[model samples]
Target: MSDEKYRETIIEQAKKDQSAGKFQSESPGFRSLVKSYVSVVSPDRKNIITEGLTAIYKNKNPQPKTLNLIDYLLGNVKYCKEASDVSYAEFYDSNGEMVASYSNGKWISYGTKAENARESELWGIYNEAWNNAARTSQKNSYVAGTDTTIGLMDISV
Candidate 1:
């Protein structure tokens, strides 16, 4: 079959899948998150475009894993930071279970169970935590009294 015909067939199948609950729609928040990430971090935003095209053309699921938003961000950071040459330094939790490691520029963690493993939840948490950290860092950049000045308007007598 021709490429056009194949694409048409896939679209039809996707429509059917949607009707049959074989597919799902992403939440607005998720879409916004993706858009924001693409707009900000991705070089040329090609990663976002490539992912979108993959889902549309190759029928790849946009939600590749069950991870939460923060976890996803952390994972991406991990992948980018850790390349492949070096592994993170291992660390364990209070219970002696290995939890997190930092290598290159990534963080790794082993969760309690497979079901509770790295997922979008992790991504969400990571994002939240990272944001908070970033905010603190930004705040620290303020020069005590020099960064801000209080202005008072003269009151009419």
Candidate 2:
């Protein structure tokens, strides 16, 4: 196109936009409102231990005794509503292993190196192992903070 014609077209479009009062601005909040679809790690990672049921010795048997690991992460394993879409959480270890994992929304544990455990499948051995490890780890260690967010749906065009 000729320079004059291109300039005219630009001017025409600008006038139309101005008349309609429909121009966009470069504001930070606007940028955040229409962000590119990017997966972010959820920021909720902490070890939450629930107390296990206490046993009463009754009579005079020198008070009651505790059983098993801490009550925090036992038998209270909860699966995300969409567990299939969940990926293993990751953490660095002293040995520098990738240490992919699962968690109780709190504590985390590492998965196995077995081929099946590493593969993806519904209720796959690996998935189960990771879940177990995460729960166990949560029971044993302090909860770590995470900022990972998975993209479950997209609204941006």
Best by the TM-score measure: 1
TM-score of each: 0.20, 0.16
Scored by lDDT, model 2 comes in at: 0.31
How many clashes show up per model? 15, 14
Cα lDDT, model 1, residue 2: 48
1-157: candidate 2 lDDT, tens digit per residue: 4435533443444334333443323333222322211102111122211211111112122322332344222322222223233222333222233333344454454432332231222123323433555555565544332211222223332
State model 1's lDDT.
0.38
Where does model 2 exceed 4 Å of error?
24-157
Best by lDDT: 1
